[model samples]
Target: MTNHWLFWGFWVMANALASFMWGSIVLSATPAAFAGMLLGIVVFILVYGTLDAYLIKQNLSRWHDALRRSVYIKAGLQLMNVFLAFGWPASPELWAGIISVGITQDRLGIAQNHYPFGFALLNTLLTGAILSLMVAALTAIIFFIRKKHESR
Candidate 1:
């Protein structure tokens, strides 16, 4: 249970860091604007990470057992994760947009600028999916190492 919490906590922290850095780099956000962005991102990460971690942890037990017995199943699962990665982006993007409204108004004192929803959506989805796939690839490498170690 503690480990589960820790896992999710780290995941949330990593996400928060990524969001903050990305926002800073792309938007050249002021400190206050970045704070607002970070606040929204942290909220999204907390909620999403907790739920995702719970599901993954539960499913991982079964996966681990099966993976230990069959390389084919392990490879297949990793392949599916490439698609599962697509589901991760929308919530954070939505939450960030919503939260940024208040933050921009209050802190930046900037008038809200309208962005086309479709363009933003497509951008977020593509970036998120690509990042997620990168993570999946790293995970596959770790699994490979573990498998190799176990066989020795």
Candidate 2:
């Protein structure tokens, strides 16, 4: 349950960040903007989902090393899901659906959107940091909780 929450939270944060990044880079509608947004979404899913899954798997393995091998395989499956589905950009709805699948497969929700961009490059940098931090915090919290529960 906790894992689910963490995963969704991370996905939501990543989604929002990707949108913000693309929005800042290409404000007006152009082929470049469309392509950039697609690329951004792909990168975001790969990086954030892979890292979070790895961390969770590591924590889970600590409880039962014998289960580690299977856990690793499951991680690969999850990674594939994110890469194949969540990475695609057919439409905003499709993207959102894929991201939701990634989150729910593990059990999780979208984090609060914090668009910190105000003006210039600073806006982009700040917004990116805020989004990254939001996802990181959720990931860390889930790992911590899992560790605590396992330790018991």
Candidate 3:
């Protein structure tokens, strides 16, 4: 915790790595979708693993400040997933993001084999938001679990 570089560096790395790999990790549809969702949760945990540790280390009366800071870090990290559209190997599977929401199609017309910048950007934002909410819930759950354990 004393080493600022180490803390922030790992935090970024973990989130980036998760975002970079999240889309590609989903295998298929139907019954397998459940497994894929489970895998997605795993990725969220990977992103949040260090964050939870870092927040626990801070031991402040209010964890909201740390949560806010982490969401910003996550959003920034999501930007790197732009490569997803170029078939960078991590493109999100959400091929139908609403254009009005600033997300274009996963790619242009078939045979074109290209992805809109907005597609990746929207996926990035959506996932980042989901991750923030999920991790916040996780943080709370973890806090209560820890409190209960400590009381014992």
Candidate 4:
């Protein structure tokens, strides 16, 4: 991360690849260059925004240990989604394999099926963002209440 060349190279390569993939998805599904680029930008922003927030939170944890617990709680709850997808699964390894393939198909293997990748990806991205925002707001509310109670 300290190496400037390496850092910028990562972003440049990522955006270029994203642009090409999104452009292809857009052109094939809807034939709109403008929409494809916009979609790329939107996807980039959503992903980097989350990453930046995560990085900042990690940096803050250098002094504030509670932040680490909150992150663990957040992640544990997030991990529940995959396990819950199986509804009390008895086998962890089987569930992990099934979830990996399911996610892979959701992202890449939609051509043979009726659901195209573009619309499905866009729908899921927006839905996930909305749900994430709601979770952040709720966490903030709980944090404020805890701070208030601790100050008493």
Please provide, for model 4 over 1-152, each residue's C-alpha lDDT reduced to its tens digit, 9 standing for 90 to 100.
34533433344234334224433543345434345345544564446445545656677532233333343343344344356456865332233334433553566564313443443444334433443454455556666766788799
Looking at model 4, the pairs that clash are none
Best by lDDT: 3
Could you tell me the C-alpha RMSD of candidate 2 in Å? 13.3
Cα displacement (angstroms), candidate 4, residue 138, comes to 3.1
Write the number of the candidate with greater lDDT, choosing between 1 and 2. 1
Models 1 onward score TM values of 0.41, 0.37, 0.39, 0.36
Per-candidate count of clashing residue pairs (backbone under 3 Å): 0, 5, 0, 0
Give candidate 4 misplaced runs (Cα > 4 Å): 1-71, 81-115
Q: Would you list the clashing residue pairs of candidate 3?
A: none
lDDT values for all models: 0.45, 0.42, 0.46, 0.44
Per-candidate RMSD vs. true structure? 11.9, 13.3, 12.7, 10.6
- Model 2 lDDT-worst window of ten: 110-119
- Candidate 2, residues 1-152, lDDT tens digits: the string is 46744654555444454445445443444554345445444454555556546656777544333223322332232333344366554333234333433443334332213211112223233333444554455545555677788799
* 2 or 3, greater by lDDT: 3
Task: Give the Cα-based TM-score of candidate 3 against the true structure.
Answer: 0.39
